[model samples]
Target chain A: MSAPESILKAENLVKKYREFTLDHVSLNIPKGYIIGLIGPNGAGKSTTIKILMNIVKPNSGDVKIFGLDYKKHEKEIKNRIGYVGEVQYFYENKSVTWTGKFVSQYYKKWDENRFTALLNDFQISRTKKVRELSKGMRVKLAMAIALSHDAELIILDEPTSGLDPVVRREVLDILMDVTRDENKSVIISSHITEDITRIADYITFMINGKIHLTIEKDDLLSNWKKIHFKKGALNQEISQTLSNVKEGMFGSSGITDNYLKIKDKLSAAIEKEDIKVENVGLDDILISFVKGE
Target chain B: MIGIMKKNITFFIQYIGFLYPLMVLYWFLRKDSFDLPAIMISGFFFYLLISGSVNILESYEFKNNVYHFFKTLPLNAGDIVRAKFYNVLIAVFFLFTANSVIYSIIIPDKNMQVFSYIFILCCMLLTLNIIAVLYIGFFSIGFNKMGKLLWITLILWLVLTILSVEMYLIKLDANLLYAFISRINRMVWVIVTFAGFASYYGLMRIAIRQLEQNYDNV
Candidate 1:
């Protein structure tokens, strides 16, 4: 869209497995912004990230990182990307310093001073073996390595999955700091909507390997509403207008992005006090969509 | 390339220790003045044991999900396979030299023919190592398949060796077997050695292409 001022653009990415298929997934990650790829487990979030990283190939599609063809300029594009996957896979017997030294050799602009500073900031011991470190510490180490490489775009897949809240906040803050410079950007995929809302500028919600919505965070929040209707009022016409609906003993509640249109269609019900509308948070919106509520 | 080699060496350090028993066995066998065939058979098994550590290294990487880590880096499939090839060659060279030195020290009466024989054995083992890396990396064969392949190959070699030995004793007589072994001259040895190295790089190129094509599966 609009000629892709985006640092990362994936078009028509398709990958098939026995149980899952990432069906024609496409998304543009704009430059100088954080776009959260949000979805539930098994929603193809990791698959999409893998395709972007070239860890897995798409059956048919094109991915361009930094506007360079992913296949043709993979080495150059990867050099500019700092990525941390959902699982940590450092040599378990090696020290943190060894892992850092091993990884830093691949990056042209690896900054040892910055790496040391980040290690100090994160309180990770450089001499400690990777196997001796906890999962949270390993994540911090990964983040520190990713940041010290002068990467222009950071792609994190569930980087905060197992961390304590304190460390999670620290990681998010570090990501926010990365985006402070207008030239840097981030694309984080997570099931935790709150984490995305805390740091993301835009949101892309995915379900069953298909993208459900891609909108600005503020726009999504401003437009989507969870409307409740009295029992016997949720007829076929009203149901057709809502994206997801759940009926209970007392009434029916549903979500709709076209709040104004839904309100106009049910003006009679509104005046008669049969329906009420309330704003939905990012968490509620995602859960409603995921649960088909 | 040097960085990847360093990583592999470090990872394989624990495995190289297992070769000490083979060295000790070499000493005991030499004390009894074992025949050339017995020594060569022992050498083959020792080579197999040493190179088996490479399989261990691979299993650890696969178990820990380390393949994707390297795939995500600024390294192409050829670069990755080249690193592995070089690393394994270096390791094999080290182990081969160590085993040869043990054989030489324990069996002090051996002539120049022993050195030539060792050289041929080293080249042959190196060729097998290169071929193994190509097939395993290109096809994404896991440890189970590799273990099975190794077992089947070893069993087949054992059967062939027994059959050859039986034919030598029974049909052709021992003189015919000795004549065949004697016909291997320096020129032929040099040619075989050169061919071994040539085939190694040839397989390396093919493995790189296969790796690039099937990188996603890897």
Candidate 2:
């Protein structure tokens, strides 16, 4: 990896509240790759996006987009960046067409073709007032607006949240399309493991107010594992080998790899008795990392 | 600038078309009282003009990630503010001009005496509104911090009008025109209006920089 194709990066980023701080978080989103910042609720995902957008005041740190400092190239950076916040609130009384028409004047690269195509693809009525749209549709309309412009980097917070499974799939499909162009990239924060698994080549785990890790998807899948336990595996033996169990109950009723470890603990007889072991999903690693058990 | 400006103008025109006529009718119905029409028009103009700058809420939305949809566009934030304020001013100007013409035609003698008075009163009303908007916007910082701003504005405007009543009285008399000409000039009024507008414009810049600093710490 001779110098990853970088599109967006935040360095030593720190934003402090009375009670919480982002704690010197840094991220580099390589161009053309869909990066997922996966975290549980209250993990400072939205805060980071706000800082990157230059929406909030930062206590310390620098944000660079496409290798340009945010302070010097704010307008230029903004032109290339598109953001959809966790909560989508537009002028409720305004029609989609009115909002679209108004936004068209602000972007030099506003492609009316892409705008209309996204509107149709998402099945949002151009005549519909923003207040009338459902949460899923509101998110879809936001995505449409974010993508209509020739944004080099799209930052989204909980874009798939509160959507039905079908709608979530649709949103991810659009995201996948956005990343097909090598110059385009996305940094989406989501709780949806499946969405991250589908398109995110790079995943960063955020816990508490700080980032816990940022690992490539291939490294995660290749290294992480879920070890299953069976009856007669001594509880004391299981505890000795698997000390990092974040959540799961014993009693052999369900199949959960809460006991996943680098070393195996099951008896040789049980290992050959049709028991199963598998790689961990983001959700599993995320739970363990976040709970920090 | 043009696109956002057009949106604000479109909104103001639609709002005033419905609201102003009702205000005029209210004045007509209440004509049993002396100078109530003038008072009513002045009050409406006061709020509408001030509402242009008193946009703590609008500024909040703009400062929030809410406007990423718009800010990411080519339009500048100040352009949006100017467009909003200008739209309201245009609406206010139209109403004042129309009323001035109608009053002149209806009661030439009575209106002429009242015209200068109303003109100055409306001017003061606009100036004060602009001042109020600037102060509220500056200290409140953003819409979320506007609790005191709203109440203070209401109380301050109330206290101000009570003080300006004497000036309004002097305005209605022809002899006072000599004093008025000497007391205030066109350039002074421009300076006063722009001073208020410029001060608020400067506050917005300060707040943006402060927010950026806060963001970097996160």
Give one digit per residue, the lDDT tens place, for model 1 in B1-218: 56777888776566676666665676576656544445455555555554566667776776666667787678877778788777766666666666566666655544533643554365456546544553555346555566566555556656655665465446655344445555668687678767766777777777777766666665
Model 1 lDDT tens row, A59-173: 9999988889865787899899988889877878789998889888889999999999999999999999999999889889989988998999999999999889998999999
* iRMS per model in Å: 1.5, 4.1
Q: TM-scores of all models?
A: 0.85, 0.77
Candidate 1 displacement at residue A124 in angstroms: 1.3
- Looking at model 2 chain A, report the run of 10 residues with the lowest lDDT sum: A251-260
Best by TM-score: 1
Please list all clashing residue pairs in model 1, or write none if there are none.
Answer: A244-A293, A245-A293
Candidate 2, residue A170: Cα displacement in angstroms equals: 1.7
Q: After superposition, how far is residue B56 of candidate 2 from its true place, in Å?
A: 11
Badly placed stretches (over 4 Å) of model 2 are A229-276, B21-79, B85-218
Cα misplacement distance, residue B113 of candidate 2 (Å): 6.0
Model 2, global lDDT? 0.67
> What level of docking quality does candidate 1 show?
medium
Q: List the TM-score for candidate 2's chain B.
A: 0.58
